[model samples]
Target: MSLRANLVLATCTACVLVLGAVPGTAGVAQAHAVLPKPVAYPARGQLAHQQAMDDGACYGWARQQTGVDPSRIASAPVPVIVPGGERVVGAARGAAAGAVVGAIGGDAGDGAATGAAVGAVAGGIAHRQHRRQAAALSAQMQSSNDWALSSYWQAWTACMTGRGYSVQ
Candidate 1:
């Protein structure tokens, strides 16, 4: 496989690993944007406390009506591959291939060392590029997700408003 593709795969593998290591990462297992906090009419004091209760009620009602769980809305940050562990794998694979190719030439050991160094450098560069692309794609996805979430939030807010709670 091409170094770039390998790096990309390795990076994705690492992302999955890191995400797996995180505790409580099993909720919903899907990406979504966050809902805007509602602007309660009563800002503070006893009425405000009551408003909090109302807000909670409205949130539950909204969730029931809209099927959008606000708690699980925001998704985890996308993983970007840093140039690390992947370099070792790349170097090893390259050396093995290079050594075979070099055996046909003359000096297998020299060829293997040179190939390994080149492979490691190439892998690092590829990993960096992959990370950049992943970051860009992630940002784009987040934008789209945010838009979708806003639409859902709007529906939820409207439902709450219809139930007689001030929602913005």
Candidate 2:
């Protein structure tokens, strides 16, 4: 597969792995497959069996229209909080680099101190930026998930209603 395909596949796999399935549910997809349960009545006096058939047809259409498989929504990945060590690592690296420079000029200790401080500040800034990005990504994903679900249910409801069911 191409790089983009590989990345997409990997990300989806990660989502399933990290989030797992919702609890107290049976089977694989069932664990997370929570479709909107709008109370629907057969207004056109359709038979119970016919209602079931319409329900199945509408469900398929809804999935096709929205591309939001309820089965996969629950597996949406939450970003893992990686343990922070950027500042310390940055400080150490900066000190080492600074020490070399300082030794060429005069005092290694003073150079190391200046380097460490500068490195720590830079690292701290980088860390903050990372956190912000993670937060933004998480919010965006949630918004997307919400939209997908709403859109799917709306489509599904519309389908059922069109098929002579009084869908709520």
- Best candidate, lDDT: 2
Q: State model 1's lDDT.
A: 0.58
What is the TM-score of each predicted model, taking all chains together? 0.55, 0.63
What tens-digit string does per-residue lDDT give for candidate 1 at 1-168?
446445644654464345332223322222434556666454233365666676677777777766766566564544333333445556667777777776787756655665666666665565556556656776776776676566667766775566566656
Regions of candidate 1 where Cα sits further than 4 Å from its true position: 1-35, 42-46, 74-83, 129-133, 163-168
Q: Candidate 2, 26: how far from true, in Å? A: 34
Residue 91 lDDT in candidate 1: 65
Candidate 1 local lDDT, residue 154: 76
lDDT per residue for candidate 2 within 21-130, as digits (tens), equals 12222111112233466878999999999999998999899999888776578566544444255556666677788788878878676666666666666765665565
Q: How many clashing pairs in candidate 1?
A: 0
